[model samples]
Target: MARALNDGPGRECPPALPFVLAVGVTGHRKDALPADSLLTLHDRLATVLKALTEQAAAVQEANQSFFSDAPPRLLFVSPLADGADQIAAEIALRLGFELHAVLPFDRGRYRADMSDEDGRVRFDALLSRATCVLELSGESDHHLESYVMAGRATVAHCDLLIAVWDGLPPRGRGGTGEVVRLAHDRATPTIHVPVAASDELKIRWSAFDPAVVTHAEDQANVRTFGEEELGAVLTAVLSPPPDEREREFIHMFQGECRRKLRTRIEYPLLLAATGVARLRRHHWRPEIGAVRTHEEWQTYCDACHKVAAVTTPIASLQSWYEWADTLASDYAQSYRSGHVFNFVLAAFAVLLALTTLVLPDAKKILAVAEFAAILAILLNTQIGVRRQWHRRWLDYRQLAERLRPMRSLKLLGLAAPDPPGTAANPTFGRWVDWYAAVVWRGMGCPSGAIDGDRLKAMASTIAEHELAPQVAYNKSVANQAERLDHRLEIVGLTLFTTALLGCVVLLLGFAFAPHWVKANSNWFTLLSAGLPAIGTAIFGIRVQGDYVGSAVRSEQTARVLEQIADRLTRNSSNLSRAGDLVEEAARAMHADLDEWRLLNQQHDLSVG
Candidate 1:
């Protein structure tokens, strides 16, 4: 039976969130209220200024990373008036990030009204860099806002919007509020750094999807498919047919599947050699031949989903897709949060180390203040790092290790581990391969698109929720282990050297002191003091190192997990369409399963 996408419920992909950056221009506003006290204005200005500086720096970093370092790339920015805008422009110039303006009024008029000398310069500098600076010159009403809104709406389609807010209520000058509101309307993650919350910054980065972005926009993007609609679609593909000729067509289709299996495994590869989104450019494949009508296919799809619901508590393939989508959303948030947290903590650790150094007898004080700062930062960091490792990387690793064709692992005498909690999906590698294969066939992936790299990226989506706690636990062990090992290495070296230095000091004390003093010198006393300190140092180093070794083992385990995930991802995508086609062909030909298995097994595909 032949099936077309028209014969089945169409899988949906989320739309892109536009990257809009709203920069708050700093400096004095001309119209300060008569009621406003100088102190209050100064306080507000101080808070706002601090926030702008931070937001600008974060924006610059994000600009560099998003466009150059990762996917869902960013190119343009939406900035408003304020110091934040200046910072944003500075970043754009350095990184080559594009800028566009949604002006509230005529630029010349706005400039004429502004009193501050630097303010005009700041505004002019920002204007010079914009790709397109659109004016909000409508009637003084909501629709007038549409000029900018329309501009934003156009940008929102590209993916990502950055809104720099005062973190206060929307009473401030300029349209930072509107920028944020519009971005939310588009289901975009707003990188909000409140003007007052200068010391801390929170980044909400989602790859795509409304939940991560907002309520209204999400509603606009995701379409809910009912059973009737699905049934009508699936009715086209089935075994029973209208005529013998149609039955003959089905036979031909089945024959095609057979030939496809015996020969090369094609499909599942998304070749950028053609280019990204090239599938949209390619001609559609011939429809699946089957006796089932579109309605019947729909019925089967819905029924299968309904039955799936009962069989699996979460129930239904549709639900699973939804779950996967949700997982993708949450995954992005968790990943970003974990990373940001680590980066901040690491920074804190460095700062703390530096601060402790300035204190009198800091080493003695390090045991007190340094320990608390170090412990807190390290603990939090370890927890966050481990969480990230488990959520995606570890699962991918384990799957890869399990899924790799046996001979490759055997060559190194390496066998995949049945990770402690994955009994339910013993054949994770196979399952992932199956999922990828289905995606491949539907997508018309030609080749290389479904390689090792693709598989690893795909498996990142498969990180289970249960894995979270375990990942954290694993990371904690890893942190302690790493800390211990590092401490050991540094301390061991430090102590041995210190001991040797102490003997030298003992000799030097005599030489440095006068001969009379040396004769009456408390040489024995100095030796006693120095020797004890050296012993203490050595003892502490050894003790710390020994305890940390266990943590190191955990770290080692984490690395192994990462490797396994990479392999699983690679194997899964490679096997996707081709793997299914091969098995189907073998089944139709009635070839020996054992021989087929052996033939597949005997050839080490890793070399290729």
Candidate 2:
């Protein structure tokens, strides 16, 4: 049975920690800011932070089941630059938010870039106050690129961005304007706090595509940043959207229970028939309530500890991954089994109907049996559809897979990229991306420097824990799918061939001896008609499963992962190269997932 990580031999599991709301800041430096307007900017920043904190508390209280007993936490992400970043960070600190500083360079070099002794002193004071500081890895000569990267990282990590801008274009590569644009591009909600009195404060609510706007000032759906608008944005970020379908999904995810006996029986039968049992003999029997145990979590924790000390964020993410992965496995089994059972039930129903010809005196009984069989198929399909088995499996698996690679990504201070075009509008009824963003915010950025030794360790961990295992899994899947497809084809063809032989025999018997032909007509009819129906059912299942297509895709993916693994081995010490390879491997896996989802989406369980 599955037990919680903290559960003892007989103890119940504890609830998970509450969600975090991360807000980031980017704006003009001290030199660019008007000296007289500093107090106003400070007050505006304070208002925004205070409003978000109150809104977040209300959201968590309203949805107690979605959160833990503890209240939701606020995280403030900033680069702690001389002007706007520091102002926002100070306000956030006063509001009881945890401060996470993302610096463009190490302390000494960064301090050297400050204009005056006062600025440097303030930087040191705030840096000392921060809970975590992530100094990005880069040389002093490439400072501009590092700053741009820092801006991107801030946007990537935060749930919301606060830009203390002056309603103008960027003055340089990593200016406040550039950061705001990055937030717009990534669809991160932003509250634009004007540095001047004339410009109106606005919020880019992330509801429309910025690409459609011809002018910067004319960005689509820019709303005035007021109490009501900020409340709406905060509500949207703190919880799943108000769509009914999305609400249903969240409920199901929270419930996390399954009871599908038909699935348990049907899934194994399909596996056995398709030759998948040859790969794993355990498929011959049903699972005996195998669940993720506490021991399994301990093992994962041990692995993570080997890479680095077990931090709160790492442990939290690992726990979530385990929960999602297990739920995904259960749903996948149930969904796949529903379809397989439909195919078999369809075949059996026809065979039951054909039994009337073989036993004419018991036609009524056969009719009832056939009706029951057909009913079973319909009921199975209806249950699968109403419960959203297929969608839950895909979405939960996507969530789990995305979380799987974060250990490495977090070490290098990288965030997973959102799906293409999701910036405008994410997929309906799918909140996995949103959930992931929230969790990423909770984790914040890694709190240290990225050095050559750390890069080597990350490379080794990825190769051992991620790429190598995935390569093996893909290879296994390729072989299983290829074998199953080939075996099913052979079995289907043999059934049809036997039916032809049966027809030939019936014709010969009719010509040689009419009485004999009439006496055994029922058996011959079954051989000719029943066998063909069974063969057609098998063909339908094979086509719907797309075994051949799966084999090809898995093989190609395995090859790509193997190549990435090789590169990791060659360039283990290069952090930039390792980051790229890790991303490449993740992309390959994501592409494969997209292809698999597309292939099976149209193959919903049906009587046909």
Candidate 3:
């Protein structure tokens, strides 16, 4: 199938996450500067921006090695007030970097802040040219709060802060120093472009000290930077080495599993998805149209549109796979730990029995070992409960199954389930659903309607590659489960039979060999008590494993999936019928998974 589609007026498939350098500005107003200093400051601003742009380009080139699909973009974010903000925006535009404007209030209310008539026209022009304009909504009565938040917001969004100041304390609310202070708190690197009210054009640069203990200390201990350090600083702040934490997050989502063509490229295709944590959007392809028109595009020139794009459908699928694999691995490890402890405890009980009946040479003091073993078992149970290993295993497995069919539906470009409520749904399930929603929304739908040919292709693909294999897998699982159940039954029955035989022996000894039974009362008593305990413990272990119940559920799931597979295969030739069949099968699989979870829920960690 032809994957490439023509790009036009509609929404473009967003590009991968681009290397964006968001620079925020805070500085002296025109009123604060001397009349003679204005032009020099403007020229100085232009020089710094030009240098930064070049530095950013180099950083982008280096980043391209890892994030191949992401292009580099330089964006200056500011609220275009009379002096430094307007100057910086104009300089950034002149340098071909994008501008993003943030306002504390509406443009009409904000226009009043500009005393310069010429500055007002310039502000409007700059605002119009901005790639994105973020207008914060709040009560206008508290002007200071609005101002402070806007500064905070700008600082929050920016990678670097550009302070065009003389290192003076802020004169009022949300002043240059205040914003700079906020930036310092966040450890966001700031470039201090010292501008005085003098006509003498001595341009010097400095940066905030991240290690400074206090704002006062930071202000006092500013590190002066020469031209030689400029490139290094930009590289450090903009394209620093990827962190270990980020690598761990990525690794968590990557797993070896059977995947569709889309899922095979899940990691790299992550470029096509964007979002902020739970909130996300995805771009299905890179060649689609821009999200905004040219006019609207101007408002977002500085925005990295791809950042909010949805996760790749394949990637979402991969996440579920990874989660499932992790759950299985965790469950197996937990089960093994529990089983070992139980076995050791059982051995201790048997040893105590032997001490009373078979080993007359040993003193009762040896029974202390049995008591210690019993204590160990109690401690193990407590530890397991505290860790919630069993609960986590069940939860993650349920989560995995919930997301299982989403990948297939996403691949086929079908509608996905709605995002689950965090309050109502299980924590893992809610997150899974939220992630799927983000991918679904970001992907939107295919541009044109699904025609017969597309339907036929989908059906053929699912039938040959999906349905046939799924049916076989389910059948195999059912067979394994049945065998396991049979094995469990045999083990349980043998324990009971041994206990029964011991009872018969004890009865016969009591009836026929009364004198012998009297001489060996302790031995007979030990056998009578220990046999039932051992038998009961064995039965408890079998029940705890839920081997019987699990086999039953697996058998049911396998049968339903097999039936659905048959329907899909039979209707593969008919496009309409095949589409419905595929959807039905996917839903049926999901339903079966939910049913299996419910069945598991019925069986807790029972030793009774």
Candidate 4:
């Protein structure tokens, strides 16, 4: 069976999986709406939805590798308010889009806030039709802030925002204009449907511009969103970039392959060294299992399901993470083994060549063996470089780590955290970001009211499952790395010290016993040459692995996670506080991963 790196016992490798496109709505309520404008607004909104649906199909067809057989799911996110919200929900339902309602208050309070009986009835009808409802908790006195939170939540959850506005500034705290601004700030695509009688109903894309004035004239001046423009936007958001290397990597990762023999051979040495070190230590017990198993993942999903109102595709996210994690482990083993074997081969080649001096009768055989060793080194390095084992290991590990936190982030309505400086570093794998974002969009938000009780439950679950396990894993990694570094350092030092003693012995023998020195000179030469060559090789492996650096980074990360876990335990009931802790934990993990990538990227396989 193929082994996973740092995987917990009983972990199973799974096979590979598409995404959901969420469209949100923000517009004026019925009381403020012009009667004549409603019909045109409805028509334009429907047209945009239809265009999106059609364009999604085209993009899926073009990029079938990225998606499954099922077409992309279209989710309509709305608060189901009296006017524009209800209108968009109705149109979305008619177009077969799944409605996910995000309300500022619970259903009862939201219904009672409607001014008229007819509006209340419409609201209930739409609410009943919604596939899932996310009710936000808010006190009566702070209803305006709640509305702002709801609007921001809707914008955060959706891929596209449809603002049915009158091309004017927001009159209230959380109205159509405010939602549009939130969407703009988030860089979510928005389609503006003019509801003002004076402004024509020409649908256009509202590109986010930080410098643009928040006025009707400036908003209306943007270019019209025609069919081609909409298609371009959909394609850009939905499809991964046309990078052939990434595509090839996906194929290789998903294909069935056995573990490399070199990696298998190296594992026992690593295991023995770490196992001895762990046996020597006594104070720390693992907080959680070292490896994450399928059963553990199921437990996590069960916790999420218990609190969630609607069914979330969390298992799908797990499968993606598992697939990436498995591949990353495989590549890590291969890449690390490649360097180890190269170092060993280089030292062996030196030893073999030096043996010719000791046994001159076998010079031809030693020369042939040394030549083969050199050839093997060239072959190994070439294969590693050509196959990109190091590159794939870094990329897949980065992707897996990003996906790992989504289990908690999705529940909190937070997107996957990006590596720092991703925008500035053009070499960063943008396709990884696109892939993670697609998974996040596909999972969407769990529909339900997050009361204080639910907030506390989710926080506890995160602490127990997410943060605790990571803390344990990081500590274990740090210990293991420190132990390996220490062992290698000792071994390298012993070899060099013995070589130095051999030199002193050879010097003393030449002065005191010339005949004895002449008889045993080959032994001294082997000691002086072979020991140092092997010692240098060992040193090279140590540097290439960067075990000491890894230990320090992992230890620091463990401390940060412990701090976050403590804060989460204390502020479990506060939703904002819990969300902040989760983000902080995620940032810490991302920082660690970034450091690991930087440390390993420059240590690619080389003959030296």
- How does each model score on TM-score? 0.25, 0.86, 0.45, 0.86
Error of 2 at 528 (Å): 0.2
In model 3, the runs with Cα more than 4 Å from the true position are 1-313, 336-340, 343-347, 350-354, 360-365, 418-432, 439-454, 573-576, 602-608
Tens-place lDDT per residue, model 4, 376-454, is 8899899989988898889888888888888887676433343212222212245676667777787776676777677
Residue-level error in angstroms, candidate 3, position 133: 28
Q: What is the lDDT of candidate 3?
A: 0.55
lDDT to native, each model: 0.35, 0.74, 0.55, 0.74
Off by over 4 Å in 2: 1-17, 61-65, 205-218, 258-263, 278-312, 355-372, 382-387, 419-421, 426-429, 511-516, 559-588
Clashes of 2: 0
State in Å the error of residue 309, model 1. Answer: 53
The count of backbone overlaps in candidate 3 is 14
Q: In candidate 3, what are the lDDT values of residues 560-586, reduced to their tens digit?
A: 766766776565444335434655666
* Residue 425 shift from truth in candidate 1, angstroms: 26
TM-score rank, highest first? 4, 2, 3, 1
Query: Cα RMSDs of all predictions?
Result: 30.9, 4.3, 18.6, 5.6
Candidate 1 per-residue C-alpha lDDT over 22-109 given as tens digits, one digit per residue, 9 for 90 to 100: 3222212323322233344434434433343344344434433111122222234433344454454455445544555545444665
